[model samples]
Target chain A: MNDLTIIITLIAIGYIAGTWAEKRHYRSIEKREREFLDLPAITIKNVDIDDAKVKNAEIVYGGAVISVDYFKRILAGLRNIFGGSVKSYESLIDRARREALLRMKTMAPDATMIINVRIETSTIGRKSHKKSVACLEAFAYGTAIYLKG
Target chain B: MKYTARMPETNVNVTPTSPLREFFVLLSGVIAIIVGIYLLLGLALNIIVPRIPMTFERKLAGPFINSMASVDRSSEKAQTAQKLLDVIQKRYAKLPYTFTVYLQESPRINAVALPGGNIVVFSGLLEKIESENELAFILAHEMGHYVNRDHLKGVGRALVFIMISAMLLGPDSSAGNLLAQSLNVTEMAFSRNQETLADEFALNALHGTYGHVGGSADFFIKLSKEANTGLWGHYFSTHPENLKRIAHLKNYSRIHGFAEKLLRNIPAIINKKRPA
Candidate 1:
């Protein structure tokens, strides 16, 4: 009975707090995304540009770690039993990936564009041998090309 | 190609359906399945309990019951309790299985009717018995549970759950933990009706063995007085319920014309406290 009460309290906190944080994050992510819209982050390795015009090209990277709320974790655990799409985790991954990309764009504000962008997602939490907090890290890396006038 | 830099018309990656809505739906689905299994298990118990043979049950009870072997079975209090239980069993409650009484030195005033005819009599309850008739009634009550196989039904559901969890999900699955928590199984799982029937069985057995129903409700009467002191354990927690059972015992005695006779004195060993 005590355990159930604690679990329920955590889930309630997770739902209320997690949803609010997600909404605020998505709002900020969209505003910054629009601001950095012209500086496109593309996956293609090749780009048509003169070598002389490209004054500097270097790798820019951004990483974001998002911890799962108790509510979403419970929802995903339920989903695991039912064998279906884990919708609870979908927004988590989406937020982390987008946040990483936005941060990568913020790193190269003066660049012409970012190309050959790759986003790598990995879980760095809840391992048996380590005392780690539960969270997922999304790391985005790309080449930021600076064009000389 | 000119990159228009247009955000997609819609965020198709995430399904537009409300996550809370999905959460509720899936949560309900899980709850519904659990409730369904619980009901099915209840029905299955009705079909399964009586079919279980005494020998098989003794074998199944071997591991856990043996762990309790350290509790003295040859002591005077235990032997006396066993003798009374045997008399009740042989004369009135002719149940198939042989009952062994174990006396454990515990402050909890209770007797648990374990599977395979093992009645664990806590010294707390033994030290309080004022008469042999009361002890006989208590033993008969446990035997009554055996007669109706209520003991098996009481444990069958929980045993099946643990086994199912161990066999399907590993023992530590959160779902199992959640289900176990949700059920919140009490120490006493026998329903009120089952308890009333057991009381009736004990009343009849007392009348048959002792030629009277003199002390059928004596334990409850003693328990009711102590209930207000806040020291009584789970068995008598509900004072009103104990009163009701006392009334039921009297009414049943009157209806059956089983007269209250002179009470028999319990062996001196039962009333004496064991050395710590």
Candidate 2:
């Protein structure tokens, strides 16, 4: 096939597949997020609950690594040249952070609240040969609290 | 009564994981984009090069050639050089510009064709040539550069590379050197095609001048032997393998019946006299 046809087909596939996957992921995240509303996760420095009300507290953590789609990568590369915000990469990081937080919540399903929640992000699969970032790991850690009966 | 302050709070949202399938899709897309850009640039250059005028090319090459060392016209090697050049020039008398051959005093076995029909022949190459036919082949190959106007195309490409590098990497940037090195490699890649075309032109010219393609591959055959033991062998060298060129010449000669008129044991006529 001709170069133009091949390039067009690649771009089309990237756009359609990338958009569909992102939307599906967001929907799934939203449904899971609704289920975890009762177990509120917060980044506050300290919890206000009385010591008598706190039965037990333990550290809980969740981590995940997410890879960016080709469509988003191409957009990010173009943004590098023009010098502006890369919205696609922004979404990619957002998804990773949220996924990490959800996993942390899953670890303490019976806990009343998780406090001092922190998120750390790092890049993975960054080989010298590939120009773009392959994957990003997001780790979320917090102290889970169980209220006394 | 004192009012109680509400505690500062931060909300947490879950992010979805990216599937393995998406990574492959993105990688393939990026590869396609890179390939597309490379093809486009190649197509543009192929179309643009031939349109450039010869006068502009001469002006561009003039300074570079002037800075190189040249041999004195009174030298005995220069006299022999002129005789070989005269025969080639007579064959191509209809060339638009005046053709002149300059003998360089260097020991490097090389020849170069500059713009405005100026050809430079190294003393080492002259010493290594076994017969007049071999010298004629070398001269004709250089003439092929003039006919195809490859020098101009090379200069144009170099200027483009420099301009792009300067724009992307500032003048003092260390990356400028890297860019230049890559450009040199690309230039060498382009030379492979030009070299093949020049060889064809040389073969036809040799047949016309000597009534055969005899001794045409002698220089390349000798070089192939030396190339094997050389520090910078044909593997890393810019030009194609010498053995491949020799085989090509032999095949062409056989197919065209030029091998039938082969002249054997022709002694070197130019090296008989030494300069005073």
Best by TM-score: 1
Model 2 chain A lowest lDDT segment of ten:
A1-10
Question: Candidate 1 on B169-256: residue-level lDDT in tens?
Answer: 4676675777775574432443667788888999999999989999888998988887655567466542227889999999999999
Candidate 2 chain B lDDT trough over 10 residues, lowest sum: B7-16
Candidate 1 stretches with Cα past 4 Å from truth are: A1-24, A40-71, A103-149, B1-10, B15-32, B164-190, B237-240
For A1-149, candidate 1 gives per-residue lDDT tens digits of 45557778988999999999999998998888889988989999989898988999999999999999988888887888899888878888999999999999889999988999999999986789743347999999999999998
Q: For model 2, how does the per-residue alpha-carbon lDDT over B82-136 read when each residue is reduced to its tens digit?
A: 6666776676434555666787766567887776667877766776777777777
Q: What TM-score should be assigned to candidate 1?
A: 0.78
Query: Which lDDT tens digits does candidate 2 get at residues A1-149?
Result: 24435545666777788778877877787778878877888888786668999999999999988887666676666555546455567767777888899999999999988999999999999888866559999999999999988
Evaluate every candidate with DockQ and list the scores.
Answer: 0.30, 0.04
Off by over 4 Å in 2: A1-80, A83-149, B1-45, B53-56, B69-79, B172-174, B183-189, B229-236, B260-276
What i-RMS does each candidate reach, in Å?
A: 3.7, 12.7
